[model samples]
Structures are given as structure tokens and as C-alpha cells.
Target: MKGKVLSLGAAALLAGGALLLTGTANQSNAQDLLGVSFIDNVKPYLEFRPRYEYVDQEKTGKKDANALTIRTKIGVNIGTVLGVQGLSATLEAIDVSALIDQYDPQRTKYETVKDPANTRITQAYLAYKYSNFVFIAGRKYVAIDDHRFIGTVNWRQMPQSLGVVAVAGKPIQGLDFLLAGVYERKGIVDSLNKDWKMDKMPIVLDVNYQVVPQALRLKGFAYLLTDIHNTYGIKASGKIGLGNGVTVSYLGEYAKQTDPYQKDNVATKPDIDTDYYRLKVGASAMGFFGNVMYTYFGNAGGKDAGFSTPLATLHKFDGWADVMLSGAAKGFYYGMKEWCISAGYKNPVIGKLMIAYLKFDSDKDPGFGKSIGSEVDLLYAKKLTKRLSFLAKAAYYNADNGYCISECNNKEDALGKNDVTKYWLQLDYKY
Candidate 1:
């Protein structure tokens, strides 16, 4: 988790042909472009997203952050390469421009807004298919399941990607598997400090089987992050139909983390062992859906260790306000427990609207109070056209009376001690 950041932004290349390729290249013409036999299919895509974000933190004394940013992504997907039937390639570039940069991209004077002004090659990958297996290499988005353990942080203006060599396959009718070795991870921080390189490439393995087509599915995964920790887990999820247009869904997952394979002979190596659990139940009918969930992250026996998902999309879990994000990375002294309730409605004309409430507590009592915090989040998204969309989101966090501060054994727990509120309005256009 601690390593040099790969600076891919140094040589920012803008592919001007992306615009032209998206418009005029048909199959007949693409097949014989520039005397090449197998440019068989060329599809170019572009996305422009302009967003405004406001953040207000009560205890942080610094000025509130107002970040207005725009994200542009342009890419081309080549279905066939050099007349090879199963060979394909994808190239993408992303740029984030800030109009109002009043937040901390790299520990600035203002509050923290993860959006930074920079450009990088977001995705560049080559894939080849043979039989039931597909081999992938280069840099691209690497996500597993729900993105809880390993994922692309797609919520931010600058998403996360991995430099990896991977193989994926569906060898049977109801089974799927992926094995990847990740050498570099590009996070959503500033481009200069975004990519993380480790002494050894992390290994990820995932296997899933549909026990019953749409009724039950089982999954097993192991993630070995060098110098961090190895996490292995099992998950079972399923959906059931009760009546006409009504369905219920459920999920249960459990994981354990242990010390990873380490070779950086430091004075003192890390000691980590923890447990994690997540349980959820949900139901949906007639354009309405609701869910109740419980999640637990073990403390790794407190002090300087804990279970954390270094490669996860942290923003999607814990709380929308990120009240538990930083602290969760180091593991709390008393561990952390979260209870969440969410409801949403979707309509073709009215779009989709959702609201979520989350409560955080400690697994064990500290001298102060077990109460951690609570958060409320609201979101509305609508598609304006075939290739355009609008989204609005807000989160409010109210801190509790757990003031152990610097004098406490676990200062990292104070990451959520300050009350914070944030709002975002965004527009996305894609072609």
C-alpha cells in the first residue's frame, strides 16, 4: 500500500483521431483502412462531465471547499488487430480541469476535494481470446464483484486503474474465474501521487458459480496485496421472485485478513489478522426498492493494525460523506460496525431517486462512547438524452460524542470526528 506513485501524466497525449474515428468509420471502410486488413471494427467514445462540489467541515477551521471541475475521457476500441480474429486493443485518455480549485488535491490549505487538475492515460490494454479464456495485459480498469475489495474508483473525476497481466474465463456454463497480477495501481489522487508500485505484484483470484441460474450464486476470492495483507472470503447471493413483478434479494459475505508476503526487511514487520462480515436483504417491486444491511470491519486487535481494502472503491461503502473512509484504512481500536438502510425509486420519465441512512458504531467500547457517527445521503439521476445525463447528490454527517482525539490509543479514529456536509451537481455527455 505504500510505494512510489507512477506518474503517467508526464506525457499527456491527446488523440485527435478519436473524434474522427467515432463518426465516419463503418465496417466496410474500417476493414481496409490505410491498407490494413483487420481494423475490422473501430469504435471511438468520448465523455465530458462537468461537476460542481461544495464541502463544509465544522471542526476543520479551514475555509469550505468549492470545487468546480470538468472531466473529459476519449478512447478508441479496436475489435480486431492485424487481422487477428480474437485480438483487440483499447486506448483511453482522461483529463480533469478545475475552474474553482478551492480544495486540497495534495494537502492544500482548503478542505479535501479529490478532484485534481491533470491528464493521464486512463486505459490502455490489449486482449487476446483463445478458446474459453481471455488474456489481458497493460493498464486498464480492474474490478471484482461489487468493488468492495478491488475496484475502479469511478465515482471521482479521476478514476482508478491497474497495470496488470490477467486471465479471465468462463470454462463452464455457470462458472467464471479471473486471475490477475497487479503491478501498479493508479488511484484518484493527484496524478503525481496516484499510481502505487509495490515491491511485488499483488495477486488476485476470484471464482464464481451460479448454483442456481438466477436464484443462488456463490463466490470465492483471494487477494494478496504485497506488504499489506492477504484477504480471502466467500460470498453467497441470490434473488427470489415472490409474485408478479416482485422480488427479494439477499447477500452474505465473510472474509479474513492475515499478514501478507513481505520481503522488505524492515526493523519490525507488520502483524495483521482480522475478520470481516457483511449481510444484506432487499426487496423490489413496482419501481420501488429497499435494502437493509450490516457490515463489520475487524480491528486486527487494535493499535497499529487492522483490516483495510487498499484497492477498493472506498467512497461507495461506509458513507457517502467518507466519514469512515480514512479511519477504516488503518483499522479502529474498537473496530467498526455499520448499519445502513436505503430506498430508491426508478421511473422512465421521472428518472431515479434514492435516499440512504447509515449509522456507525464501535464493536467494542472505548472509554469515551461507542457511538461513531451517522450520515444521510440523497441522490437523483436522470438521463436527458441518449447520450447525456444529469445527477445530483448530497451527504450530511453528524459526529457523535467520541472525543478521544490525540490522547487516545487510536488517533486514526478521529478521521470522522468532524461534522461534514457535501453536495454535488454533475452533467455528463457521452458519444
Candidate 2:
């Protein structure tokens, strides 16, 4: 699911560029642009990561079967620092497809979404930056350092999240602070068939202090999640650094949600209160880093004390094999608890190879009721040169019980779980 194209976004950038180059570029306060006289400044960026893979899906589901997949993205930046410091903007578009093989005449969205499905966007935005603060008003990426609790959701073929107006400050040499208000910004057009369930406004605050100069760092998060039907009290995270390229982090999140229109089936109970927390630790040094993490979510989002991170980040922590990306959230193994331990090895000459084993267990019931599963993944990533790179990946997921999500969780459709085994090769370039 990787490739690149300008789509119609370039047109808008060019139009905006003409406004800047002709109208504002001549401003006496502005700097020369490439020795070329212009109205506005224009810069383009391209991100392409295409993959070829073999996939096997459980035959129990008609739509779940073996196939191949491809992904791509393109972006442009227009506007200038001439008239005003905050007078600039950016544009981005992406395309995704899947099929039995390149030889197949038809392609699917994300190369995985069954039925004739695809996704497109005009992620455009304008922003102005001055001092330590910036204001963005468009569908741009919103990500923090580790992305454990909040992220831009960039790992998927159609990565999505929200737009935000954020302010940051550096009062001291080693300290930094941030405050932001998030707005619902996912591509709204593609989700019209169903009532697009979205949050109202989520507040995020973070602060980082450099304790031992560059040798150690500490960070804290207090995310206030609230919507019309639910309110997540607050979420927290702490990161610490130990000398010698080693770092550790922890998470303490709690929340509650109550919605009668929260599920597919009409027969579900409302969660008066669902509170849970997790204690996770991770380390990476030189050529090795592994993480042992766990989570406990209660009827927080729906299924009475279930473990799913609505505001939490499911992208950064997982093995990247995608076994737990979607369906993992719809399963019941979360009622009790879940954990994973993963590690990696780096070979400077070739690339970095990683392996991980993830297991989800539930005690609410057994044998076809609520169950546990295991997944194994091995992958390698390498940059062939400054602008080109490649990745090779393989994985296996064994669901020793009923459909991973159907029996254990209600949000099954979003997460496809039919015991899958897959392999893929991807090529990427930067421009």
C-alpha cells in the first residue's frame, strides 16, 4: 500500500503560490527565493512506500482470504514567510489499493478492505509560526514524541487523526511545555454511510524537563478526553532516560463512557464507570531494544471495563506486523488483561531485523467464549540510499478460540480476525 502522486493538491498549491509570488514575494522585508523573483515560496515533498506481499486469511469468512496489497502518498507546501511569519500552508494526498495480484484488474482500498473500497483526501492546511508557538488550521499530522497515548495514526494505508491548535514554550534551557485543543479532522466524506461517531474536544498537555543535560529526559502527559456521551477523566505517561542510550516509560490512563447508541447490536448495557491503568516499561540501546507492556481497560468505551484505547495509540507500540491493528480492539481478551514482549537486532551493513511474540488472554470465560491468541513476527528494514529504502516482513497469528472479536468484543467489523499469515516487501522513497 505505497506509492506517490500529486493528485489535485498541487493545483491548489500552485494557485496559492501565485498569490504569494506575485503579491507578497516583492515585500521589502522578505528574503530572495532561489535567486528567482516570485510571489510566494513553494516547496514540494513526496513519500512513497509500495509493497508486494502474500497474505492468507481464514476461509471461514467469505471476504477473508489470501491476496496482495499496495500504498502511496504525495504532498506539497505553498505560501511564504514574506508578508507575515504565519502566512504559509501545506497540502497532501494519498492512494491505496489491493488485489489478488498486480495481474488482477481490480484493486481494493488499503489493498485489504473487502468489497469495492478505497480512500482519498485533500489534507490541506495553513499555519503560522513565531517564537515557540504555532497555529495550524487544517488536516495535518498531530504526533507527540513517543506516540504511546496520542498520535497521528500514521501506520495505516489511510493514516488519520485530528487537526489541532497547539502552543508550546521553552522557558528554560532544559525545559519545554505544550498545550493543545484537538478538533475532529479525519477525512469525513468517506464515512457518511454510518453516523460517524466522533469526539467533541480532547485536551492534551505535556511537559518535558532535561534533568542530566542530554543524558536524561523526563516527560508527563495529562490528556482530558470528553465528548457528548462520554468523558475520560484523564490519561498520563512518564518517560525516563538512563545513561548509555537507554530509556524507560510508564502509562497511567483512566476513563468512563456511557452511550446507548455505542454498539451495533441494540442489546448492550451502558458502562456507568470503566477505569483501568497499565504499567509498561521499554528499553533500547545500541542495537537492541525490547518492550514488555500490558493494558487494563474497563467498560470505559463500551463493553463494561473493556481494554481499548480510543485516545490511546495502538500504532507505535505494536510489532508493525499489523496483527493487532484493527481486530485486536474488537476482541474480549481485554476484559481481564493483555500483554506483549518484543525485541529487535540491528545489523548496520544489512538492516535491522526484529522479532516479537504477542499473546492476548481473557478469563471472563473459556473455550469458544472469551479466549487468547499468539502472534509471531520477523521483519527487516533498510535504506538502500539517501532517498530510497525497503522493508521485508512476515507474521503469523493463531486464534485458538472463536473469531477473535465476535465472541470477546462487539467492535468486530473494524478488526478482521481470521487467523492470518502473511509476508510483504516494501519500497519507499523521499523527495
Candidate 3:
């Protein structure tokens, strides 16, 4: 009975198009086009990136988590395919490895890390575009504006994508539409039951139009979701620019999800309705920096208006540590919520350095007097060259309760002194 679960919707389409992308798919098209391809309209480019990290996971029994990742991408955008074409492929192949023997000599006291690395083909797809429309088939990428909902699994050693056929068209001015028919079959190993009865059928429909394009900078959106897990939601966002580089942005969402039933047609008791909203405003002076953000989650999880489903993108608003996707994937998080205020200074005049700071606060659980969590973060990234860089980050969390979840938890140290520290460095290359 212990196995994995995969969701396959009726139309069977999986998401890979990025509207708000994280770091990985930055160089999607072809800026590195060579000779004739640039002139003949067949653009070709390549990228090679290598990342190395060392983490000290206090609860894993081991003293460190060290590994190396090598990412390679070679793609071509052909102007004419069989005498007719306009499309491209971004990433071709990638591999990850753990160099267990290469322990840092400066830190002789630490233990060796394990080899938990993996390898796989990340992206391989073809695209076709005509004046006001775009079409993609095979394995590609997807991220919806800030990764609020579905995004490419770029954080994994071997992320996931679908065998998809999608289309984008502007049906009218100020209005656009997207539709796709995705492949639904799963590999036997990935399909928990190996029955392949098509476990997921997701039909996504989203539209955003400039509501106030002139005097006020604002927009409205409607998202319709249907399938394996029956549900739908509405979201809207707007921004106002105060004079002199200052601005405010607000976002809100409400989703009502029914239950995923077993064969008996029995509905899971107390289906939940969830709502989340965030309002943040900040100012910019050159690249020197500033920001303030506040987010709130509903109080109850099992009933209506509370917790959100797992694998759903919450990092759309906050930073991506993926620390929140824990729990029953259906339970409520205690406390009102939290706020984050961050600011930073990029490369200094005297030294080549970048540093940032984050201040956090804890909110008391709905009806209780006890606080949940509070923390601080210090991050720095330095460029060795335009193509290579290194990063060092630290986090400090002060929590009074047992902060435990399925992915990451603060349960190992029940003494409440569950403070944590983490740091890492990496080298990158892009072409």
C-alpha cells in the first residue's frame, strides 16, 4: 500500500510554461545563435552550468549534505521545419552528482556527505508560433507569472514535465486565451498502482486583462481548474506607483476544493475552502534596495477557507526554500500568519559584494496566546566574473511549538531550542 500517487486529468495536459519563472529557464530563446542560423533563422545555442553545495542538516544524523550538479543545454530554433517552421528547444540534458570524498580540508571536523545525486533529461520540445498565437509539443517548460500556481520543477536533481500539446492565442485585443491537450500516461515505476487508469485530468483556463491601463495601473484575472481533484479559484492583483520610484502591489486568491474519492464514491469529510491574500509595497532608489510584505492564511484547514493543497506553488509570493509544503497537505497552519521586510545593497563601490537582510515576526494562533515562529535571514552573493558567482546564506528561526511537516520539520530537537543555521557556495556558467 506504500506507493506514490500521480494526478492525470481528463484532458491529460501538464503545465510547463512559465509566466513568473524562478532562476533556471532565464535563457530560453537564442541569444547565443551562431553563424548562418542567425541569418537563416535557425538559431542555436548551448549552456553549461555546474553547481556545488555543502549543507549542514542537523537532524539527518550526518554532519553535512554536499553535492555537485552539472546542467547542460543545447537547443535550436528552426525557422522552417520541412519548409515551414518557427520554434525552439531550451534545455537538452542535465546530470547531478555527489562528490562524497571531496571533504573541505578547512573544516576537518565534519563528516563526509552521502551520494544522493541523479541524472535525467530536463527539456526537449518543439515550438510553433504564428503572428498572434504560439504552440508547443513534446517536453518543454512552464511557469505562470511568479510561479504562483504551476511551475517547472527546476529545483530537483531531475525535475518533471509532461508530453504536452499546448496553444496560446489572442482572441481579441486586451484578451488572450490558452488551451491544450496533454498526454496522460505514466511510467510503470512512476505510476504507484501501475494501473495507468489516468489518475489526473486538469483543464486550466486563465485570463488576465488590463483593467485600468491609464491613470491607474491595475489588472484582473480569472482561473478555472477542473479534474482529478475538482476545484476552481479567482485571483486579482493591482499596483499603484506613488511618485518617485515608490509603489504598492496587492494580491488575493480564494479556492474551493472538493474531495478526491475512493471507488466507493464516498466524499472525504469536510472538504475545504481556502483563501489567501497578500499586500506588499516598496520603493527603489537605483539598485540600493528595499521591500516590505505581509501574507495571511485562513485559520481552519479541514473545513472552509483555510489550508491550501500541497504541490501547489506558495513560493509565488515568498522566497523558495520549499519549507511550507509540509503537513497533511490538507491541515491548517496555526497562527494568524507572518510578515517579511527585506532590503539589500548590490555590488559596493569599494568591494565586489552583495548582501541582504530579512526580518520576520510571529503571529499568535487564531484563539491562542502562544506565538508560532519568528526569524532573520542574511544572504550574500559575489560574482567571481560575469559568468561565475558564489552565494552564502544564513537563517535563524525562533519557534515555541513543534514545527514539524512531511518535507522539513523542527521536530528533531523537541527542547524548543530548535534554532538552525545553513550555508552554501556555488559556481555557475551560461552560454
TM-score of structure candidate 1: 0.89
TM per candidate: 0.89, 0.72, 0.67
Task: Assess candidate 1 and give its lDDT.
Answer: 0.80
Q: Tell me the spans in candidate 1 whose CA falls farther than 4 Å from its real position.
A: 1-38, 191-199, 263-268, 402-407, 410-413
**Cα lDDT listed for each candidate:** 0.80, 0.55, 0.44
Rank the candidate models, highest lDDT first: 1, 2, 3
Candidate number that wins on lDDT, 1 or 3: 1
The CA lDDT at 232 in model 2 is 39
Candidate RMSDs in Å, in order, are: 5.1, 6.2, 10.2
Ranking by TM-score: 1, 2, 3
lDDT of 1 by residue, 46-89 (tens): 78899999999987778899899888777778788767889988
Candidate 3 runs further than 4 Å off: 1-41, 87-91, 101-116, 153-160, 180-200, 213-231, 238-256, 260-270, 303-306, 309-322, 327-336, 347-370, 382-386, 404-417
Consecutive 10-residue window with the lowest summed lDDT within model 1? 1-10
Report the C-alpha lDDT of model 3 over 1-431, residue by residue, as the tens digit. Answer: 01100111101112222212332242233223421222124444445555555544344354554555454444444444423445544435444444443432323455332223434344556677888888887655555555555555454334445455678777667666666544432211132111112233244455656566522322233332222233455555666667675555555555445443321222333444545555655555555556676765544443432444433434233332323333213333441355777777665432233333322222323322334445566667676666666556554555444332111233342222233444445555655
- Residue 406, candidate 3: Cα error in Å is 9.3
For residue 305, give model 1's deviation from the true position in Å: 1.6
Ten contiguous residues with the weakest lDDT in model 3 = 1-10
